[model samples]
Target: MSKANLSDNKMSATCSLSEELMALLPQTKESFKLDFSEKVEKSVVILLHQARELFYEGKMNECLKTSETIRDYSWEKLNTGTWRDVDKEWRRVYSYGCLLKVLCMCFKTDDIGEAIRVCDMGLLMGASILEDILVKVVNVLQKHLQHGKRPETKIEELSKKKTKSDHTLAPAVKLGTAVPILQCPSLEFFRKNYLVPQKPVILEGIANHWPCMKKWSVDYIQEIAGCRTVPVEVGSKYTDEEWSQRLMTVNEFISKYIMNKNDIGYLAQHQLFDQIPELKQDICIPDYCCLGSGEEDDITINAWFGPAGTISPLHQDPQQNFLAQVLGRKYIQLYSPEESESLYPHETQLLHNTSQVDVENPNLIKFPKFTEASYQSCILNPGQILFIPVKYWHYVRALDISFSVSFWWS
Candidate 1:
């Protein structure tokens, strides 16, 4: 159906949409009452109630303005402290603003594609609230388009540019030490040999069968998830004073940071699979994760996508990690937990897991013992997984434009 048909049948579409979307209001109200009542600022609570009333009265513009006010209030609370200090009340309030804003956009706009983009904006920026109601709404809108119940303007095909760099790939670092490499070892062997002793090993061939090895290219990611919003870390590493985070569409992140490479932007440590489930279909959880806890929900998967030269400063994680390289290569160095004293951990609670010493360029005068700490290094290639035992001090740097998934389990 052509988009022009929408004006003729606009009233019918609007009427039917009211019936469908109005059903979600009661659920939204109940969630807000439960989570926000007597908890958040009075102004926020009042605006939320006002937004709901406006929405029910078909005053979408008023509702949108009220929702923006609520969002602004919540964002102030969010920015008062660091990202770690953002509490559930603030996130819920912010999410409600997004929810209300998306609903208003959907109700007022004739363009379904623009409605989807609004939903994506919320999904990219909002925290997990009300069982991810935004995701639910997006699914519903997408179904309407798929069933041809609503006419949609064509989505222009994004430029499928190759991730070629003008700069030459840096030579792989050689540290005179290497983690043991295992080729598709049996689960039994992996558990008894490596998992039991809490040793790190690079496992090859296990991930070779995954579809991501063949299907995931820079273009493929851009095609599938380009429109999606993501939190990107901007700077060479987080430990730098100038380091900061920004939220941008994946397409913008790719063009501005990933491709250009003048400034580094890393989409690091984000649970992207939960946000975009279609991308999750391209890979499977490693069977080895079953060795720990044996429960599916206990596992945490994060996506690390960035340009060459993006660095993860030396840090230790609390859970065991299976770092899988889906595309490009990375140089990873690991130090045992026993060597923590020599590695010079930061004094602050926030950065206690991170080493004060820069592994690549150490200041031997400030921390003379850091040079004496033993470590293992490897150039992790595509279709390979590196097992990092809990509290294993690891430093990572991308050797090329890279996309890696990490599965962390207890």
Candidate 2:
């Protein structure tokens, strides 16, 4: 069968499970023909058709269920015949990690404390020991996809190759599972990098690539930081009870402000205390939480900076973002919109688009599927940038008294 046919078959197999389960996977808009290269086009075809059918049918429950089960078929077959059981279980443990994650999101939105528990269960499962990252190819592709700007370079040559190339830096370990294929990065180094495409860049040679410095340094930052403006969006409506309760500490920071999201559109302006002056650099951050260009807009840029314990709930940005760190440390667990089956975005209209679990302390019974999610973890230091694609579910922690910048672009 052709590539599109195969992935579609996977989705058809998914539809056979149940209508509710099938409604979970979101459409990518790109065709089974357009997505997945020749290598996985067949698989994409199978996955795509069932996804569309279930979504159309509103079989969210079944869509999530099938997505959970199908994660295994995508694992790379091993050479050791006897190890097959281990392989299957491995996929089950993690694929379910993604599954429970979705279920948890369903509950978190529909029900809450329960979703928090589910998120924790998934984390403990170690199902996602190996994870795939949101790889950003060259800017030309990003520019092309975002605004239909034609590539000055040859698009055909870039399209011809799969993702394994020099610029698209993948993890050090070999990933033996079926990875979703996106166009890899081009050879150009200066004008673009994944960080740049995702947001603006700030190079801090002093803090770039420090392995574990981000673990708990907010107070340290409050004392020694320099004057750099950060975005905040708390509205006039929220009283001190809600605002102070939300933005207070690292832990409270994540819950009320980061993960605890509502449409109040509250904001806070931040100033980092310690930016080494001899370095002669201070960043003028953008308020991307309310992002738009020239005049008309679709998104915004909201921000938080503090010690360990800060958090942001799993929500998708209508537009893409570039998140970079200036000091201390942080961790981000991410899942794309296409992987909604694993993340379990809400079903209830109240929190329909919001993830269900209280990522700070997830409750599991209500959101059993959160236990199955496999997410990409990013550690941002003085200068590293993480390009978070639009609509991906992300859970974040301060790790330390951290100073960071987020750029939201159309």
Candidate 3:
């Protein structure tokens, strides 16, 4: 009879539909063995089912508590090993717990903004559980919610001012040889000359066609994904002991890290294109990746966004990488596979791919041979793509507020 009552009925229907969808999710296969210990696996299964049952029975508070228990247990299991070592089943269980928890919260408190925030937290912090049901929930809830107010313009203005006045150039490195630049070479020529020979080359004019070349900017991204949660890397580099990751809204990241410039925070090496598909529409996968397995799924796309001075330590990757500079400038120094002996790669298995020596301010006393290592350096600008062959040791530092997309293919 009234608009408020009509809105309430719609929300009720949405929640009911969500619950039905959750019920329809396939149960875990009993035949498949989980990688966790038998005790952990048993707890995970029992707790997950209990959380779901409690939620279905309409015991929202109890359901929330049970879901939290499952989340904490699974998280402890996750922390016991490296990210790669963690079992996918444990991640799945953890994500399901998050889903149940968020739903219970929504059922108890009819706060659309808080509901969206919780869903975002699960999407960023949790794993792909139930075919990414959290994203679906976000889409459904977004229809009922209005967009938040724009961020303060002072930060925007300050960033533009800094970009213009802060002309601090990249420190002149000793390695003077610049990477060879090529204008839109044919796919056949690229494959034959650089890809086959495993040589590094910077290509121009190819990425000019991408919409991001013109449409993407700090203000634009903030306007689009300001409220969405994302994982931000804190500190100068991953090698630093103080380095750590935090999950926050993209707006918060921009306010505290990018615009404020309080500390170095890089949103590096994340599949942001997958998280925010709207941004992915702006760029296309390079044809050069077809030189590898030719499967679209084989290519790994990662987004790197950070302010000036964020450094990627000298490291080698197992697959060929094409680092495309979409915004701002970056100073990149690369070493061929032949120079591995001089690079002084870390001894530990975890850090073996990363070099121990700091390429920028090298300690020649400890790494005497680093000086003899031949390196090709470049000031990669917007719209340029740097093709790095497999195992090419590269050290990257953002010369300004930078955003780069990297495609890694075998």
Candidate 4:
């Protein structure tokens, strides 16, 4: 059905809870034993329920006003309590208000991006309950969006245009050279030279002491992780239409991808350490993580295992990272946050953290600005750790069957 018709059907649904919502307002006002603050809380609950009824009754403006009132009340009255206490009631109500307001904005103003931003904020605030509802709203907006205006579609079009123009007009341009390599730099030296400057660097001796360097081979990994089911990336790169994810046993992954190079199957970004304690014993977190908030346990360790030629497209992570190459080699390219615009980061919410430009092969015609973006590259070899600062764009391609561990902290 059309969006308009779907909306109309939703509007036609009976709002039977209207009377119950109205009844709560008077009960809240007349409760003599209740404290003023308790009364206000009850009133807010009633108001939110009333707003939901109004929304079902097609009173979009009234629903929006009620939602805003709840938000304002929560902001002014509930900001003083401890987070553990406040999040139980006030935060949930506040998130509900935000969700309703965004839904109204989507329906009334047709500002899908604004709606999405509000949803992002809600999720960050821990409103996981609204995830399904938010997804449905985004799907509705995507379906109704004008042709060629959707972010992913627009990016695909730009990629095609660049490909066509590459043959006729602009010549290819190189991005930049390799990242500087340091041997066993001290924690202070690393913090001062690389972390502080937000520069990418390769450290040679950091992972030499790690037991994984000697213990983790294809045979050992297959024996330990064989039966465990894992989420694997099934494509060469995420930018392709055929790209997808699959779940399979580690044994199957090893046999299909590692033993024989049939396709680019990768165990990318899986928290293998958390899932397998035996594997965790093989590696240790680098000492430089102490430079952060000192919450050593808060560090997230992920495993990247894949066959030769598997590609991880240009993407950025939100935390400082130590990528330790335990087995085989990988070619990595990195760009600083300052060069984001030049790289043409994906405008779509889904791929917002990824770059549109293919780092290995640039289509200079459509993304000519990418030529101006300076980048650092490196070939991460066994027992080497590459420090990638937060929000730095990095791309990776495995030169051979590889197993790497990454620690994200900060």
- Give the residue spans of candidate 3 off by over 4 A: 1-46, 53-59, 110-114, 142-155, 165-167, 170-176
Q: Write the per-residue lDDT of candidate 3 for residues 118-206, one digit (tens) a residue.
A: 77766655677656777777665555454544465645687776765334487564545888999999999999999999999999998
Q: Residues 283-316, candidate 2: write the lDDT tens digits.
A: 4333333333433243333345543444566777
lDDT of each: 0.79, 0.41, 0.80, 0.70
Of 2 and 4, the candidate ranking higher by TM-score: 4
Ranking by lDDT: 3, 1, 4, 2
State the weakest 10-residue window (summed lDDT) of model 3: 28-37
lDDT of 1 by residue, 188-264 (tens): 99999999999999998888878888999777786667656678899989999999988777767877777775778
TM-score of 4: 0.58
lDDT (Cα, tens digit) per residue for candidate 4, span 1-410: 99999777544322222232233223342321212234346778788778777766668899999988977887654556655555445656666677678666655664444554454444334233433343344334433433333223222333343333222211122345767889888889988998888898888887778888889877678545554556788888888999897866676777666655457788985455654567889898898899997499889898999877778889999999999998878888888999999989889988999999887688999899998988888778898899999999999888777899999999
Task: Quote model 2's TM-score.
Answer: 0.35
Highest TM-score model number: 3
Compare candidates 1 and 4 on lDDT and give the better one.
1
Q: What is the C-alpha local distance difference test score of candidate 1?
A: 0.79
